[model samples]
Target: MNQYPLWKNLLILGVVLFGILFALPNVFSQDPSIEVSAARGHEVTEATPDEVRAVLQNVGVPFKAVEPLAEDKVLVRFPSSGDQLRGQEAIEAHLADRYNSALTLVADLPGWLRAIDAQPMYLGLDLRGGIQVLIDVDMEAALEQGLERYTGDIRSLLRQEKIRYLTVMNDANRVTVKFGDAETLDKGRKLIDREFRELEFETASDGKNFDLYARLAPAEEEQLRDFALQQNITTLRNRVNALGVAEPIVQRQGERRIVVQLPGAQDPARLKEILGATATLEFRLVDTEGSVQDAVEGRVPVSSRLYYDREGRPVLLKRSVIVTGDQITNATSGFDQNSGTPAVFVNLDSRGARRMREVTTENVGKPMAVVFIENRTVTEMVDGEPVKRQVRTEEVISVANIREPFGRRFQTSGLDSSEEAHNLALFLRAGALAAPIQIVEERTIGPSLGQENIDQGVKSVVYGLAAVLIFMGLYYRIFGLVADLVLLTNLVLIVAILSLLQATLTLPGIAGIVLTMGMAVDANVLIFERIREELRNGSSPQASINAGYGKALSTIVDANITTLIAAVILFSFGTGPVKGFAVTLSVGIFTSMFTAILGSRAVVNLIYGGRRLSKLAI
Candidate 1:
């Protein structure tokens, strides 16, 4: 045999060594994230800078930053301990005693990055520990929203066609409207089919036998249901996002079911409250001479409303509504010229605009109230008391295109800061969850659990690798030793690449690495067996060595390609665990091919390339 060549082997070894040097630091470097939780039934409202600063300062936690997320919602970063429980307790105590706000302890995590340490990957609730909730939306409420639209449309339709209606009642399943007489009713029915294309009219057998009912099409009924469900989900997502939970999983489960998974979530009940509370808005006329002082002095009338302007100054308005929350598209904070103080700008829908114009045109000088609930201006409190529901416009009412829930930008002014206004926006948007949701499962993983998972995963990998090394050494002799060396290098390269890519390594991912160890040995087995077969054919050592790799290439490619295809499909279709497994499996195949084929090839060529096979025992 020829002398063993060192230079070629050195070149390959140098490349592996270079990869190791480049990859280790990134793999080992870690970032840390903090976790916090909220109590059940508490909703976060906007807090002023001073209010937030005071809470953090009083908590005795060394906070680096205090960010206002929304109303009562905040992100506080502490320099020490990162213990969310401690920070929460302190804030809870402060708010309970000093601010007197109804606050709850919800879960919290670190803002984004901890430069000093590696934080654990923020796992989904299914992967890590947290709460899973499935909510069933009430079909009744959805139907009601649809019914309201129908009632208004039918009333307008009748008035336009000069048809007099004696009764209009919606019975959930169908809408029944009665005309004054048979002749008028027949004309009304024909007009409804001609003008209101969405309705299907038919005569029903009843006491008067004069009812014309319209049944919605199956597709239209389904569309209405979908619209309701979507609006509910959208509102819920907005509410959760405003709370500052990163990656809160909110998706529709079925036709009317919603699935919400709050990873690392502490108080699931608070979610129920925030989601369930329907903050509806309304506009009403304010009575004149109705002031906060009038209410305090017991001189305020039930026909009037007392409201504070953006400057906290009180004003009076009539008690009737010109428009309601349904007509509002959105609201935001702005400035008013009268008192030069901050005020809320209201945006109304087209229907709201028409109503406002009609009311304003009728009552040119009367005052009106703009009330907010859960953050949205819901209804005006008339003269410090609730008034009978009615739609009446006031002269002082300001009409604008800025509608609540408007597609375009609408604003409410009079906020202390831009932060307060933003919170208001989120509150309006969250509206309410379509229905109630209860947490079915929840668990907070302490650092101990995370550390335990890490320890166990490492132990498994170490044991598996040990087994691989022993088996390879016993089976392939010298070739086995070379395989072991390449296998070790392969593991290092895989980790280095994972670290560089910042790919998350779950428990399953570690399993992939162990499986990679076994597959890496297969490459050597194929090459060694090919060499043995060649040598048996009476081929020289150099010829056998060259033929082994050449012959093994086809088999190697076929096996790896099949495995790779499976991995790709798994990665594409699988959700959480399967995806993690696919990633590791895919990475393992690449590393195994490299170390087994290229690494072992280089080492083998070094040994037999220079005709130094005197001690070889193939």
Candidate 2:
């Protein structure tokens, strides 16, 4: 009755082998290293590694090897994480600004194993040290910006409709449009009412001028704030990805707060800079007729602004912007074809293109300058407390005559080096933050602490598994040994599946694995108990074996399916470590059922199937 089919035996054998193969990568240790990638217009040649090696030697930082990698990259391997960090500092200090260096952990797996594309499971923040940041979004500033846009839109709308307005200005999150006549104000209000239904409007008369005041509705305000938070999360994700960090977490926390976690991030200062700075671009007329000396002496023209280029030379630029970074649809960094110098190719959206076309058509021979603007917070310690102050910088990055009037597509050159071009491309490619953000809380987890967590988690899993194996072997004898053996396979299958799925393993996830170890054999215990009951009822050994699996199958399926549903719910609704726990438990539930039911049965069948016995191992 318990005779096995050929297909069943083959299937079980295949699963064991497959599980072993994919799970093999976890056994190999990862080497601490630094990856150095060249910026635009640079290459990592054969001598690149030697130069880095020489720099390390001069700095007295020991290194195992300096090897070249694919894609204009080089890897500097270190025997210790300490040495890796020291080497990173030394290399970054010695190398030119064009090279981007990132600390990484690379596995030294065998070529054959890697040939099959097998990889280890990702470790979460608890297992890999990194940084976690809590940021507060500036919703008021976002609202003010929205109002500013509304003011501009109102002015443009009036101009398009040939309705004249005295002034359209945004003040304290409200846009007020003043008109010289009530007829024009009525027309503007009707136009605004039709176009911007989301704004709450009010009207009043001031002396001879008529005014229309507007602000966002409550629902619209909430939605705008939510959108800013979401956009910042996406932008932060892109920036972290550009930094080459692995498995970084950027998620919305509360209403106005965002939680950012970067796993395996070593350079927190660089990370802070990337996360905090709001870098953008603007294209404006160079004011060829305006005097730079007059602007420098604080006699700046009403239509112009004084700014310095990358070389710190004063330049006069029109205050009216033709285009901004927000309109850029795509940007890429490379060498310009004609000059062979570093440049950023830019493409604009329809609105920006229209603006660009109008500006270039009107001022064909005039020079247009590309201004790089950055807003950041500088922290200073005063009275033993840190105080943050906002700072804004605008520098002209490039300037060239509007040659033949181009719209939508253009390239900006004049960067000092390829690094600047690459960074500009990175900023443009990653959309700008919708509003300013304040880093309210920050914490860095060291790799050593992560190692301690891993060590403790593994030790607990080992002890729990060993205890279960010992109990089953002593109690159930032959069947117990089979259960114990299959239980071990169940663990392997779980790891293999987790590795195959590339799920992140966390400390709580390890707890889930331990829970699975105890629960994996529940079905086996049920079947074995049922078999003993059948034997007491005077059934034949073969008949009892079949009846045990057959009678317990319904209970097993019912129990496991219910647990699976709960795990799915947890996975869907949970976040962070809770999600990690759910993932491991979910995978373990399936593998546990496979090993306990099919795997144990196959072993038992191989030993005793199609045999006539007076007594059973039980």
Q: Which ten contiguous residues of candidate 2 have the minimum total lDDT?
A: 379-388
Question: What TM-score does candidate 2 reach?
Answer: 0.77
- Tens-place lDDT per residue, model 1, 1-618, is 332357766777786976676454533322222222232233344544456567667666665565654334455555433444455455544443222111122223233323422233333343334445566666666666565557656765776666788766565567777775688778878877886677667886455667888777667677777876787778777778777554566778778877765653333434444543444444555554546686757676644556555455555654444555546566655566665556556667787777666555555555445555441111223554322222222222232332233222233343445544454555565453333233332233333235567678779988888888888888878888898899999988787666544455667777777877777788788888998899888887777878888899889989999989999999898755566678878988988898888888787766656664533454
lDDT of 2 at 501: 82
Q: TM-score for all predictions? A: 0.58, 0.77
Query: What are the clash counts of all predictions, listed in order?
Result: 77, 0
Pick by TM-score: which candidate is best?
2
Positional deviation of 164 in candidate 1, in angstroms? 7.3
